[model samples]
Target: MALQRVLAVDDEPFNLEIIEEILEDLDFELRTAASGPECLDMLEEFNPQVILLDVSMPKMNGYEVCRAIKSNPDTSHIVVMFVSARGSVEERMEGYSVGAEDYIVKPFGQGELTAKLLKLGHMLLEKDILEQQVEDATTTAFSAMATSSEMGQIVNYIENIANIDDVTTLAKALINCMSNFGLSCNIEFRINDEQFHHATSGMCSPIVLELFEILKSKGRLHEFTSRILVNFDYISVLVLNMPEGDSEKHGRIRDHICFIVSVTEQQLLAILTRNELCQQQQNLNGAIAMISSKFKGLMLLLDNNRKQNEAVFKGLQEQFEQRIPTMGLDEDQELFIYNKVDNAIQKSVAREEALIQVRAAFSEIESDLTALSNKVDEK
Candidate 1:
């Protein structure tokens, strides 16, 4: 890895040289600027990790310089420390007010300044490592979900699961997945004056719910996700739900679980249509088999009235073509059809006397994804 870059900006040549000597032993790529303009120019090309700025410059002082650095999105996250002879409590407050992270007074020992810089550098390195881990984990999750058919189908409708028209089987599948991960969760979706609730195993604590409530009612706030962590565990949260808004990094965390929610009513409708189509196809298959069997003998028996029989058969064919459009099934409809077909299968396989046998098969495959969503929301 490249060495962490440090920038020291002061108008006085003597002060800049002294700072270079002080930090000579540290593992950093040190750069210096003799004036405020030179600092800004160097910032454009140097991209330092931290900047030590002098507040007593002749023209643009440290406060003004810090403001310029913080205002620019590219350099805002860079640590800025104000160096000056002013060490009073009021001066420290003023320095911080203008975006200075730390204030250092002149006539200080070289060891104290070097130690502080080392600590700050380590914190930045740690934050960078955490960000990389998060990116890696996100990539792994998407890859796993993409390849697993069962997980893929369920994840396909993840955003729409809450509003799906037929949620029974899909909900069951979601719950099963959560159980596999050892998470207990509940879902509470509200619209206008109405509220809907679903739970698998454990209910989220009141505090967690309240955090969500505040987020919803007050809109996005600073450090929103960090505030939520106070009430929920890091491993437990998969996605932190937010109201529809621009994506923002609300806070830093060791294990950050962030969600991006962008839902519309049209998407919900499409899922419902898909579900209906899956159910219809299943029904049509069964109906065709039964009708074909019942008519096989009758067709043979009508050999004598061939002309009349031919007309009747043509009419039936036309009716079937005119009514069924052959459009695809949506996710919600697919689940509904799958459930209806499955229930029919279970019924044919065994009577109420053998209910446990049929249910055992279902228990093997079905899961509860909403519970996972709830766990993520709780966090």
Candidate 2:
């Protein structure tokens, strides 16, 4: 890691000496100034990460100097820590209220000063790393957005089309995007037999509508005078009032508009796909919920049948036990009949327990499915 810079501003020369002696052994590049004005001057070249300021100064106090440093965007990021003899609560509060990160007393230990500075240094390093990561991510996103050889501004606008969900907003966004190329445009988009129209200034004239109809019928690109019309299966874009004299510029503009329209048609397809997926998801969720409800009802019926079967088995076992002693038979025969009844009762109980477990398992699965369905709906 690079050495962090430290700027200490104190009117007292002895205090500056103390600070230098303590911090000189550490991993820092330290500089000192005798007054507030001198400190401000040194800040230009010595862009320190942390500033050790003394509260009492000659012309400008530490508060004033700290405020000046903070108000300027260039130097605002530097950390300011007050090192002064005024250790009262109010004095420390005053220092902090003016944007000081820390307040240290006059009789500070070397270890205390080193610990504070080290913490601040680590924090500044982390902050720098975060800022760099954000800048890099932004650069990558923009680069990905402009993969084609089109205007960067228009590419950015085209990239945002996937995020738009409403037709009216999409129309407005399209108009704004074309405005960057200095073209006055209007759009007529249709989806599922619903029509949406937007223009930059006034309502589109009847001639423009007629031109759109003519292009749609012919299924070809058309350029008449200064107006250009491009038609697709679902949408049409009309670029009007092109600069008439510059044929080269007009041709380029027309080509770019066509490219944009092609990309927009793909986006419209995505919108349609998204809508269809949402509808399918809704239908699937409803089906799952209905199945879950029916399964719960089945579980209740099974439970009732199991209870009735258990009661009948218990009653039969009781009757067999009560009549066993009274039956006139050999001892061996009586013992055999009792054993048969006991075995049948045990089998019945085990089967009922298995059914209960199966019902519980089904209930758990239904709960999981319901939760998953809700999550999909939220998305």
TM-score of each: 0.39, 0.51
Q: lDDT of candidate 1?
A: 0.60
Q: Which segments of model 1 are wrong by more than 4 Å?
A: 1-3, 137-379
The parts of candidate 2 lying over 4 Å away from their true place are 1-150, 201-214, 323-340, 353-357, 360-379
What root-mean-square deviation over C-alphas does model 2 reach?
A: 26.5
**Clashing pairs for predicted structure model 2, backbone only:** none
Query: 250-315, model 2: which lDDT tens digit per residue?
Result: 776777788888878788777787778799788988889898888988888888888888899889
For residues 1-379, what per-residue lDDT tens digits would candidate 1 score against the true structure?
A: 2338999998888888899888888788999998888898898799998899999887888888888989999888888988898889988998888787787889667888987787777778787888889998987786456436434443554644555555344444444544433334444444334433344744556765654555444432223432332112111122233222323222322112222112222333455566666666556556555655555444444433454544555575565446444547666875675566556545544543344454453333222333433444443
Worst 10 residues of 2 by lDDT: 141-150
Q: Report the Cα lDDT for residue 78, model 2.
A: 89
